[model samples]
Target: MTSLFRPDVEALAGYTPGEQPQESGWVKLNTNENPYPPSPQVVAAIKQALEGRLNVYPDPLGRKFCQAAADVYGVDPDWILPANGSDENLTILVRAFADKNDLIAYPYPSYVLYETLAEIQGTRRARLQLNGDWSWDLQRNRPLIEQAKLLFLPNPNSPSGNSWSLDCIQKLVPPNGVLVHDEAYGDFAANPHRMELLRSEVGSQVVVTKTLSKSYSLAGLRFGFCIAQPDMIRGMRKVKDSYNCDMIALAAAEAALLDQDWMLANRNKILNTRAQLASELSESGFDVVPSDANFVWATHPVLKHQTIYEELKARKVLIRFMQFPGGIEPCDRYPDGKLDGLRITVGTDEEIQSLLKTLRVVIEDSPST
Candidate 1:
């Protein structure tokens, strides 16, 4: 009659992801998912793979898929490590390097998954707060970096979708730490990717992780990967499961990567709609942070963030909300604390339009909000 979980697992509340409603009539714009179907070629490839085999195990090294990814990113096939998703890769990395009492650092109001993984790994999680403009504070973070063994940063950070410049990131390389850059939304950012940073001699500590989920619209298939020094890649390989990504997922990801035209076209569409959504929301009395990803972060200055979140949910238009203590207050309130607000993903033009229409109706109906 004893409990069967670790003390940390028992003590902590689990991470809450964006709302994914199964019921009909809800417009889900919470998870920053791409608003288009994957490439026609991807669909065809999955069908073809399914026709051939169901009985064999997948490639443990995931070489063919890795080669395709390397071809796209200009990295060596040996440096590429594919996983079920970036989430799985993150878990493996944490397990490989982090242990109880070991330290990991990240910019707060960033990816929640890092904190979740740290808790699960029984490692110490150091949360660095962002600056007023929603950028990293390198000077303040220098001490934390010097003390930590592993560091994770989401470029064009999640929920709050802004990024740091190459110069800014270069200055942040902790002398003895493995800096893992989660580039989940790098495809949509206005800046060049941190991949260039990885190529430099100064990039010994940096590793970049990407996903087919966002730009390629392959979230359902769960294909993602990391590019690191061969040693780091090998270390993660040592701890990973035998068959991490299935044959069908690998085939679909390969096809998706090859269909660059389709990918680029949809990215452009989402970018256009994202700009329009920010502008429209701003004009309607909402203060929106400029975003480089496929989502917009906004808050009504006069309206409580939670109230807005609940209101949107009641209307069946799902969006993400952050619930930090003191709730988006000045820095002194929570130095290592994450700030919270609403994260609304950019959908197709018609889908975004529907959301806009609902917002107008809700605001007009509830004058007090």
Candidate 2:
């Protein structure tokens, strides 16, 4: 049979999102979604939006959402570009900046979507491996920086939940390439690398993305935005869909951004729970990576990650077990290129307690080393 898809798309493996099971009574902690519900303002705004605007097309530029983001982030509205989600923003970025056969670079074991996006665009990819401690090494990745036209960096990077310093990231900005700081998990971190500072210094060369999904408890709403120079924002807007974010999402995102206090309160609660969970897991012979995200990346001493994941699932508790080769290697663990680990999302107090109890039982039943 003749294939209609592009050759690159035909050959490329697609991104696998975290599983969303339909069954009730399962302690779902695989995806790093916030356990809390959206802010009251968000709910109200969404309800208000739906009351009369179902028939009208959404504001194509998402001005209200952009202004809300600007007010919160201390940037101008012209610097913001709202999208259906950060994923769509990333796609627009790839399409706007790099062409087929152009070079695109990202740290290995970071967001898998970056690589997948580059593949779909038929762009050359430079997958730079992190050091033994899962830290970026600009000196080692000098060649990749030199060759690439765009770089995607995730702060408090996924799977490992470890972050790189702003100084380190500044050192890695390619001279002739755009640097995209994917700060989806920035709100949970102690010291988020300030995009405003980077933008002031480097102008359009630096682009930072933020998603309402993780922080604002609006994953289902699917809204995200990017901050960059006006020129960059203008270029990306041209590539984006005419109605990227629908009316409900725009209203919800604006309300969520306005209710920053609610988001911060939930963030503090999650951070506290994260600390307790990490401590408990470590005491139970699991090497839990220090996290700045809403999830913990951990590995057990005596069991393969797959075993632990399956065992937990069998008990009606779900967590992520990923085995992307060269994806994550914390503290020289998995030195033999075995990047297998479990990413457990932080849930509510009762939910987390339930997860801990199940985890203890699973660990106790495993065979001794």
Candidate 3:
């Protein structure tokens, strides 16, 4: 077959998402989706929206949804830019800000999508390796940050499941580039909001990306929004699709925001489950990261991570496993070594218990244990 794709596309190994199991009996924990269902009000709103609105083209600007989001976040409507999901917002951000040869800085092993975005845009990526403790290395990134056009950073980072404080973020600000903060898991974290950081002295360069996917349990609906200066928001809107968000998604997301208590209740459940999961993993000789999100990153000190990952898969329990430090395939052998455990999502009570049982048998049987 004659290949027509660009050299960059030909060489790139694209992002791999969490496994979706066809087997019904398996306990899945790979992706960090909300375990519980969305609010009844959200369901009702979506259904109601489906009645007569399907025929008409939705609002290109998505003003109604923007207003709802702004109301909840306490930001002006002009500052809220709604997208199909946070991923869409991020892609647009890179396209709008970064040029072909321009660079973007981000923490390595943070969000896999950031790398994908950088590559697709043909922009250089300055990946700052996280310290042994999984914290950002600001010193290493200082030089790259100065020249980069955009920086994609995830707060309470995925896979690692740890958060950087507002003070920490303040100190990491790049002198000239735009800082796009991915707060997909911020709802579950202890912080009230990162919007305040943008209001500070360095307000111009920061944009906070949020999603209804995690806390509101609206992953299927694909609703997310970003908060930035009005000018930045305008730039994003200009680049986004005219009808990026559908009527049902807009209506449902609005309902979800309105029922704040419902979202809080679901978040509390996950937080409790995350605590229990982390505590159990720690006691069982796994070094579990202190998670502020809906999942925990647990690594067994002695066991090879690949071995544990394979054991879990063989047991029909799915979880996320990354090849550490610039590696592409999840199964690629780690010559330099990577974390040797799993990124387990905090599922419901019964599901978590099932995982613990299998984990106990697997860990105790390992030579390290």
Q: Which candidate leads the pack in TM-score?
A: 2
User: After aligning candidate 3 to the native by TM-score, how far in Å is the CA of 220 from where it should be?
Assistant: 1.2
Question: For residues 1-369, what per-residue lDDT tens digits would candidate 2 score against the true structure?
Answer: 888999998897665656888768889998899999989999899889989668889999999888988898888899999998899999999999999867999988777889889999999998888875777777789988988899998998987898888778886777888999999999999998875545656656899999999989988888889999898899999999899889998999999999989999999999999999999889888988899999999987668778878999999999988877655435557646667789999999888899999888888787653
Considering only N, C-alpha and C atoms within 3 Å, which residue pairs clash in candidate 3? Answer: 305-340
Task: For residues 1-369, write the lDDT of model 1, one tens digit per residue.
Answer: 776999879877865655677677878898888989999999899899989868988777878898998898887898899999989988888998888877888877677788888988888878876775676667787888877778887888877788788887776666777788889999999884756888876576888889999999988889899998788888889999989989999999999998999999999999999999999999988878889899988877566667666777898888777765533325543343445678899999988898889888777766453
lDDT of each: 0.83, 0.87, 0.82
Pick the winner on TM-score between candidates 2 and 3: 2
- Scored by Cα lDDT, where does model 2 land? 0.87
For each of the candidates, the C-alpha root-mean-square deviation to the true structure, in angstroms, is 2.4, 1.6, 3.3
Give per-candidate clash totals. Answer: 0, 0, 1
**Where is the poorest 10-residue window by lDDT in model 1?**
326-335
Whose lDDT is greatest here? 2
